[model samples]
Target: MNTKIEKLEHILTAFYQEKQIPAHLSAATVYSLMAGGKRIRPLLFLELLEGFDVELTPTHYLVAASLEMIHTGSLIHDDLPAMDNDDYRRGKLTNHKQFDEATAILAGDSLFFDPFYVLSNADLPVEKLVKLIQELSFASGSFGMVAGQVLDMDGEGETLSLAQIEQIHRLKTGRLLTFPFVASGIIADKSEIDLEKLREAGEAVGLAFQIRDDILDVTASFEEIGKTPGKDILEEKSTYVALLGLDGAKNQLTEKLSVAKKLLTELGITDRSDIFKMIKQLEVK
Candidate 1:
């Protein structure tokens, strides 16, 4: 892992630990909050912001935390009896299963709201904050990640076509992954052209991440991924790996990364070379 990733973990840990807790909340909520994660989403936000010449203010930290909180919330909800029903996450017993169902739900709910609280407290101007809020709302709510999750649930046991599979992943996985990148550009006040390029990079990288996840579900052992492997196959869930062979799946991911690089080139952001390389590197799965 990169040193930056380690630093980001420290930052999120310290930030979450600093917040005062409500008496009504369960200890499981704090436990879930303390449970470690890869923090890839926040790292994505941080790396994108680093690409810019501007310094990250407290507002940026809030934005990154918002994504992390929302992600942790989603993980909690995903582990509920109604969802994946897993007993463990990140090598620890899941929040809901470890506590009561109600506690789990409330923890997830609390995690969900903290991001908005962080964002609303940003030091940026009112108009910019409003725009940021709008972007976050659309990407995280019914029109974005949530909708994708619903579709993913619906696709279980169905043999979806390649396009259908892509659509499901796009919604279920891509939206949140892309938002941090999109949001970073928004916070940086990048031009429309550059912003669009960033979106292209994010969309491609996000989709690639899902494809890699599908690949990992098959190739990785449970201990490696920290989640049960082959659940997609066990549940008969439609996935890129199910529809296409591994080689074909990687090809598609590579093609998407290519387009993402092209878009970056068009926006003149490709000059950094390594950033584009990092974006493309996700295609290896």
Candidate 2:
């Protein structure tokens, strides 16, 4: 793991340890949150803050952790039988599989709202905090991820156009992924134009990430990806791979990566190597 990601893990662990009560709900929450993955969202948040030359503070850590909690909550719910019905995530049993159905549901719920508590208690100024909350809510709420999920569920087993697929992913995956950059912009007090540029960069990366995921689903192994591979095919989910052939998908991913890098350049980001390296690492081998 990257040293920065390790630091994020440490911060998240401490926050949970201090705030989580000793109860079943806490246990369920901790179980999923602690189940490790790339921690991409939080890492993006911190990276963008750094890229913008913003000072890192306790509040920034809180915001990053909160983003992770929101992501974990979504994953817990996503893995439930009612959703993807997956048996494993991040190389371990799914939350619903590890615990009872109700427990998993509550765990997801806890993760969903825990971030708000963290944000509300943070010592940031009222205006910035409110903007953060609003951004978070918009990204995770009906017009964003939830909407994407709904569309995904509805589009299952159906042949969707390329634009349709993009729409579903833009809302479902892109919104939350964009949140880190958006939040970083808020914290840095960037101008509206700069924030829009960050958002465009974020959307490009998010699309690339999902396209890479779709490629991995077909090409990578269960052991390699740490979750069930070929589940998209099994579930007949609409994906970049389904809409665009594997080669086409790879091309799309490359295009998005190029767009992301270009957008970062337009933002006058001097040290874009980190962003480039991250995206390159996600490239389909």
Candidate 3:
């Protein structure tokens, strides 16, 4: 069986190249959309799907890609002049810089709104469909990812507690991370207990992912990271590494990932051995 990442990349790249949007708009959209990253959110959803005795359908990738669309759109918006205002992402110039600010803005807007149509039109079970929308919606809404972005930007000029930083990461990053895991159970017809466990595991891994990211912002080079380093400190933002210190951050990352793996193993998912490895890899890099 294909590991979640391989299966997901094939699905996404195929879908991405197959479509033809309008020349101008499609050009802008595909440019940022195809801009590379780990595609982690969608892979998490697929890994959860693998836990069930089901076939990998084209419908699944469509749902997964929608998650990426939101993620990419958020990144585009996040890099705007009013936001992070960075010049690099995925080791390339940011969308706004590459295509011009207005084009980047519209591309981001297209990414944001286009996924709803795909999800609403997907072939998933109705129960699964509704929950998918609910999951993604929560991850994108004011109380979720956007809320985190809002706090992050708004917090820079103010004094915030460690609790506030966690709250920011939870909403901005953890919300989407948790969605794929939790929503997969709903799609796979898993029990409520399993659902809760998957959600918890997802949250743990997601939180760890952000902490690792915080550490990377300081330690990683631009060549390795694909983005400008020291932006967090430069921006004066609070992060796990800042709050916990390097050793403390690593410890928390290890603890959360261990808990996440525990839940995944307990759920009887053997196919996700790579997923476990991937989580472990996040701590060191």
Clashes of each: 0, 0, 1
CA shift at 219, candidate 2, in angstroms?
0.2
The residue ranges of model 2 lying beyond 4 angstroms of the native Cα positions read 18-22
Q: How do the residues 1-285 of candidate 2 rate in per-residue lDDT, one tens digit apiece?
A: 287777677776666676546577777888888887888888788877777787667778889888898889999999999999999998999998898999999888878888899889777889999999999998898988899999999999999999999999898899999998788888888899999989998898888888999999999898898899999998998888887789999999999989988887787654632655676787885
Provide the overall lDDT of each model, using Cα atoms, as 2-decimal numbers: 0.76, 0.85, 0.81
Q: Over 4 Å off in model 1, which ranges?
A: 1-20, 23-26, 270-281
Tens digits of per-residue lDDT for model 1, 89-194: 8888898778789988988998778778878887988977887788777777787778888888898899999888877777767878888778878877888888
Error of 1 at 193 (Å): 2.5
> Which rank order by TM-score, best down to worst?
2, 3, 1
TM-score for each predicted model, relative to the true structure: 0.89, 0.95, 0.92
Scored by TM-score, the top model is 2
Candidates arranged by lDDT, highest first: 2, 3, 1
- Residue 207 miss distance in model 2 (angstroms): 1.1
Q: Candidate 3: worst 10 consecutive residues by lDDT?
A: 10-19
